[model samples]
Target: MTADRLQPVLAGVMLALVGFASSFAVVLAGLQAVGATSEQAASGLLALLIAQAVGVIWLSRRHRIPLVLAWSTPGAALLVSSGAVEGGWRAAVGAFLVVGALILLTALWPRLGDLIAAIPTPIAQAMLAGVLLSICVEPVRVLLDRPFLVAPILVVWVVLLRVAPKLAVPGAFVATLVVITGYLVDHGAPDLSLAPQVVWTEPTLNWQAVVGLAVPLYVVTMASQNVPGVAVLATFGYRVPWRESMTVTGLGTAAGAMAGGHAVNLAAITAAMAASPESHPDRDRRWIAAYTSGWAYLVLAAVSTALVGVVSAAPHGLVEVVAGLALLGTLGGALKGATESETGREAAVVTFVVAASGVAFGGVGAAFWALLAGLVVHGVLKLGRPSAPRM
Candidate 1:
């Protein structure tokens, strides 16, 4: 193969590696937070990988665009904040199914998608920031108590941020693995199987899971991932097919839900690299990068179980350091988006505080409440202010 052909394949391979390595820990943490057992969480990771692979391959090839799909990282972070829902893991699975259905509904009804888009950017970003605060503090929290465990992770991340910013989280994750390995080796290995297995749970929906889990999950995913993904591709001169992309991702989310995956959607932050001129100077051929990413996800999926096994065994709060570190970059972006507009600053601050409080009322989670509070503040503030007169 010529250099051009090989370049995209390599770029795709790196995309998958960085994407998966940087956030898989957060995925696991979110699953466990929502009541998944270690094995179930591992299964969820595998399901998400397969769903992403299928979505990327189908959409990129069919549309002849470099379309990448991703598991919703913000949605996962929301799960971490929401914690265990009513009826435990099965209900959480039910919520995942609901998210998929909601996504499909959005695809069929453009109005529904528009409604999600209409959510104030500050409110949406504020909600995400609030959800991330708890997790983002872990490195500091652990650093004070177990500096030996977390310091190395932070040092590696800091070094990489300067040398190769894109690789920072992945580098931190590698450091975490090293620390965990040494701890495990010194303490003696536990008898555990590294083979990942698909564990299907029968889903049962309840109001709590739907309101607290599904609704918030759906909102975060659409607002953070799908919207940004479209924008990113547009900047690169590729228009994503909205209806088709939603359909594929919606179906992918539904298919993976039974195996415990949360949500799968369009890639945003990582989309630029794969779609850039760096992948290929010829714009039309850049789809090769996305297509290659699908196969790369499959290869990475092979080790999902092993990763879960190792992290699950690591001392409490230790593995979580990696997940927390993974979210810092995202937290920064969310905070910036939330605070950017002066008009919405007060409402956004309200939303962030409520979300950061991690409070639940009437069985619904903080994310839902935070949105309601922000909207109310936004509306009331609007009513008292003067409107610009028509020209």
Candidate 2:
């Protein structure tokens, strides 16, 4: 391949690793939080990553577009919260399948697609802000618990993000590794033996799980994860096929869920690296970067169980702080974009507030609720408004 082509491939690999490094722990914790044995969770995430790799490869190769897929970060948070309430991987799997079916239906049904499209962007933004708010909280809490280890790393991160544009996330990752290593040696961290082996779990599909878990999983993944993901692509001037992307994401999530992973979808943060000019000057070449990143994700997932134990040996607060700080930019941008419009601002705020309220009505998550509320408010506001001027 020419040097032009080679650059994106390399960039994608690096970006993908950074993306995984930031959020992989949350994925592990989500599974463990929801009653997955460390073994089952690892297997499931490996499955998710493998499926994601396949999807990313096929999609990028076929479309020649920079399409990157991964487990849903928002869905991970939802899994962490609802998994705690729902009990067992069975429920989580059922939810995953339901979400997949819904996405498939969205692809199949033009009317539903239009309806989903009708949702104002601001409301979607509001819900996104709400869903992300919870993730931001954990790192702050961790910082409070372990200031010595996390604070300096956070300082380095903020300064780097401001001072060195390209190196922000990667710099944070390096800083985290150094701090974690020092802490481990200084504190005499335990020697944990974890084998990087696959442990498959038999999937059980139940009505309660389907209704309670699956549908909600689909809603949250689509509403919270997929929507902004597409927006990011559009914002970056890539006219990617949304339906096709959703299909890949749906299938990937289904495959992952069957293997005990929560819900895999398009990655927002990782996508940024590939999408941004930092990855490569030519936008077309970024697809190679995304493809390489998918390969790396598969490798990491394959070894996730063993790696989890090794990583867990580090001071927990350090990882949390780094991940959070790395995400601060993305979160701030999402918040701003979600509230930029006058017409949709109020509904968006409602969406954010309702979603952030953490109320689960009829098995749906905060993302769905936020969007739902925002839609209703937006509609009411529209009807209440004087008619638009004729051209």
Per-candidate TM-scores read 0.98, 0.83
Residue range with the least summed lDDT across 10 consecutive positions in model 1: 188-197
lDDT of 2 by residue, 63-145 (tens): 87777787876666556545444436766666667777677677677466566656565665566567667666766798778
* Candidate 2 segments exceeding 4 Å error: 1-5, 81-83, 186-194, 202-217, 223-244, 267-269, 272-286, 314-319, 360-368, 389-391
Q: Taking the tens digit of each residue's C-alpha lDDT, what string does model 1 give over 270-344? A: 689889998889899889999999999998888888888989989888767888988988999999999998988
Taking all chains together, the TM-score of candidate 1 against the true structure is: 0.98
Total clashes for model 2: 5
lDDT of each: 0.93, 0.69
Q: Which stretches of candidate 1 lie over 4 Å from their true place?
A: none
| Model 2 C-alpha RMSD to native | 3.5
lDDT of 1 at 169: 93
